[model samples]
Target: MASPGERAGEPSDRGRPVNDVQLSKFLSYICRHGAEKKGLTVQEGGYINVDDILELREARKNGYSVSDVQRVVANYPKQRFSLRSKPNDDGKLQICANQGHSLEVKGLDLVPILRPEEAPVVVHGTYRRAWEQIKKQGLSKMSRNHVHFAAGLPGEDGVISGMRSSCQILIYIDMKKALEGGLLFYRSANNVILCSGDENGFISTKYFEKVYDITKGVKLDY
Candidate 1:
């Protein structure tokens, strides 16, 4: 499905093309959660070689080429991924998810949030039922590597990713209490606050400064 002027394994000559949402999902799965299962070696920081991805049967069947990958990444609205050429310069690129990894990404590029001032307003978005469960057990990482947090409320200026738009409740973490309690937090490339919950994989409610029913625009009694 290459365009007349577009060629496989080559960069496009003009402006970036519209992103392929389906391809985005495919790459997200492979780099963020399915590399090993898909028979690709995910390197540190969740990177998989571009050439290897193109070799996947599904990719080939969809006619995805190197240019398609680059164009899609270039046009992606969110900072969901990073694509880089190796120092070896083997005419191939490596791709990785910026955050939201369902798998371990050891040494992933993240900024340490050492003080409350660094991320003054940290929140997690969820619905009512889940919030009720979170109220009892606190926040759990669930299956992911870390609990994801938003630097600012959804749709706020400079806050582009993390948390879904349909969330009915917003749980705000008291960064001061969380940090004083020996919890760790990092800022992902997409500006998400990644919290390494306690040894039990949960952030106790004692660290929550505020919980609000955002749908109703009212603060809930914690």
Candidate 2:
């Protein structure tokens, strides 16, 4: 079992061609959940020193190199990782996860969605079994730092992240209501809308503008 601070690798865009998945998952594991645990100094915006990261025991054991890391970061369809940024004081490059971080990383430079007009169709995708509980208890961030919502439906132009193609249900959020209720919203670098929800760590049912069973093509009561 993964210990308190450790976590299994999380999902990303489906059916998107990727190379070096084994190495990619390792990199993702480090950036999103294991940087602090691995003793890498995570800086503002969750950026980690690549020199430090590539020097990890596991990375060294596997003979991973900077170009290998850069290849994985560049080929990931969702653009989950950012590499080749301006060097630090010592002239070493860095890397960071665009979102889906459990670390209390400040200044990820996420764009705030203050007005509903900013994301006209912010919606969370899930399954019916979860929705049964979600309707009553509201959408929770679960393992992540914030609840993820796609800016628009899958296959919709410009909608690249935030959901899996296999989602069986879709819950539309009233952004105006969410913001009015004091739930802050931010857009990740990959265009995923994120909210920590309310103080209780749930986005209440009151903010659900509509719910639909995508498999049935019918609206469901919430």
Candidate 3:
């Protein structure tokens, strides 16, 4: 499962073939964020019968099938979806997004992050255009369920966990201060950090220790 703060889907690279990528995006849209919008039934733990998803007009038009879904699950670099046998019904298999759910899914057995050592500082990557507002108002979950963070700092081993190529700014969070400030954090299966916002759905800028404008190659003190 994705960390509680993570959202499903990644920016699509233009040069890649569109069919499978589109199918993966469509799956993430419905499975992680918009099942009800499509009138698809989501069961407890956010599982949806594979056949039910395949019944969608778009799915049929695209020639999507169980094998296609399996391929997506197996090949998606993030491992965003997981497939399992229905509880007490070994004959049936169900699929669900590992995390990043906007829908009110019940009984999702998300694991908790109990050890502080496991996550030191959580990083958030965004475009520079949003930096001013974020500097003043802080990071908000927006329409999604949680404020997502990368498990580690950027440029570490040439891998920035939660970062997208579109991002030009990186926000480094003070996790210790955040926890001391009474914020709850969870780590998703893929090591993305997840946190539900306070009553107002925002994590104030006070928790951010540093902001780097990667495009400009400098850190903004403010």
Candidate 4:
């Protein structure tokens, strides 16, 4: 039988012949949601042992090696994951997804955006098709963990916050209203805004003060 490290295959500068997209999906699974399912232990800060992650059956099946994880952490366009030195062990390292987790990761130390000056004008992007429902119900986390927002509008220079290309509508959040309403917000390492939503998984429509149809020149008042 091949050793676990040998079975993981050799590392590559380009993250190997494995498709980058597939590898990313795999990482998102184990790092964010499937660690328990895969039998890997996640620490208080959501950090997982890199070696244990590499040993996962799913990871092995996908041909993921430690090097692939390192490369993805270093080069992924959005920087969706981060690595850190394990506590009390300077030489040891661990990794975790920066955000976008549906799992209830206890002790995840996300930085709070408390001061008004530190909180940017956050925006959420969606399609026009959902406008009526959103107007009635407000923005919800839907399936994933917290509600995700971008720091600002998508720029001409191709800086994508969290907006998808298919997003046709943009909702500007009134942070003042949210803060006053007692809703807390945190900024992920990748700069995505996350908030523990209400019981219905929504941030409530009241905070969505302005809506714009990017494809159209009109602003929606709701």
Candidate 5:
């Protein structure tokens, strides 16, 4: 069932004419960061229609096939549109909006309940904050990858080491409890925070810091 010009990864024949959804996916794959305000722009259906063609032609010249182009273009248009709708103060894409853009609390916009700057702090109290931070900062936010690098982990992607797997902690501590229990801290290795528990499942670094009074006993010679 193979046609002359059609192969597994090849584009449909020259005039095959892909359907809208397929075309949309293909177009998105072709020029992911569409226009970028200077690159591609949308004409309809949240898909790029014009300038992407130019980029596609260049890709073609560079030996990129229709299928290859289709993939990259397909995945990122909605993100671009969301970024375009509300750019950060610097006019750059707010790559973090997918993480609720720090604009809501309890899945509700908190504009009425809190000020702009205060919203982040309030949102930080929620369980989803860590993921929000991850999306906003990528591998740079908590210095996860960097810490892992410093700790001597290997490979291109950062490794995870703390508390078994994903380093996610679930705890609800009020101010009084925090003062008595102490805050947790971690050391890095290949962007990983290695952790261990004596007998309990997982212990908070803050608790260790407080119980040992480590922060107080240390003296800086310099």
Candidate 6:
């Protein structure tokens, strides 16, 4: 039997040696091919592509922290890394069509201030009508307890249950801004008031279904 010193000299047999380049190539292949084969259409542009897993593994092998890989992959060429544990359903809002100048909604407005545990209020509507409803309700008016009836509560409303509740709203826009930013839809667990924004700030128009549908189809160039 080998002595303790002899055994210690032998290469560690615990883990496989990681090849960074090979791992990267494997990940890239997984990202491109796995997506095509699986028919995983791009949504909000953040997920674990094959390369991400490889990079994460290779990071472990190199004695580098997994977090380092996470940060790098987060800013990866394709925007492929996300710490978000859940799939993001938020959609983009943009100018209705070629008739208007190119415009994108401010992403900050929709970013979540609360976590899923908090259970905020959410809402959805066609592009044109979102803003009109918000203006009619007034932001300050919405915070009060008994004012939700003004927004037309549903008979089987999923978000609002008890007659009195305290909640914040999360809004999403479903209009196209560009070809890549297709017709979008927003849904949240909380009670949110939808609104429209002029590529600059929230606009006053209430987008209806026909208008939103046409815009969505037009953005896809249907």
lDDT of each: 0.82, 0.81, 0.75, 0.77, 0.27, 0.29
lDDT of 5 by residue, 48-141 (tens): 3332453455443434434433332334322212222222335322211111111111221111211222111110111233434433332221
Candidate 5: regions farther than 4 A off:
1-34, 54-57, 65-222
Tell me the spans in candidate 3 whose CA falls farther than 4 Å from its real position. Answer: 1-18, 153-161
lDDT (C-alpha) at residue 182 in model 5: 38
Counting clashing residue pairs in each candidate, in order, gives: 0, 0, 5, 0, 20, 15
Ten residues in sequence with the least summed lDDT for candidate 3: 3-12
Best by lDDT: 1
TM-score of each: 0.88, 0.87, 0.84, 0.85, 0.21, 0.21
* Model 1 Cα shift for residue 138 (angstroms): 0.7
lDDT of 1 by residue, 1-222 (tens): 443223323433324333377778888888888888888988877778998998999887677778778877776656688988865777579999988788777779899999999999899988898877888899999888889988887789878777888889888899999999999999998888898799988999999998889779899875
Q: 1-222, model 6: which lDDT tens digit per residue? A: 322222222222234433333433444443323433444332232233232343344334653334333433333322222244433434321111100111221222222222322223322323334445554542222222111111223334443322222223222222332112321222212333332233333332232111222333432111
Per-residue lDDT of 1-222 in model 4, one digit per residue for the tens?
222233334455435555555677787888888888888888887888887887776666766767777766676767678888788976576998888887778777678988656765788889888998888888888778898888776663434456676688989888888888888889887777888777768888888868899899789988
* Cα TM-score of candidate 3: 0.84
Off by over 4 Å in 1: 1-19
Cα RMSD for predicted model 2: 7.2
Residue 191 in candidate 2 has what lDDT? 91
- What is the lDDT for 153 in model 4? 66
RMSD of 3: 6.2
Native-vs-model 2 lDDT? Answer: 0.81
lDDT of 2 at 130: 90
Expressed as tens digits, the lDDT of each residue in 1-222 for candidate 2 is 222122113222332222366776787888889988988888888888887886899776666667666666666666678875645475567898888888888889699998989889999999977988998899999777899999999888888778988999999998888889899999999898899987767999999999999899999997
Instruction: Give the C-alpha miss distance for residue 211 in model 4, angstroms.
Output: 0.6
**Model 1 — TM-score against the truth?**
0.88
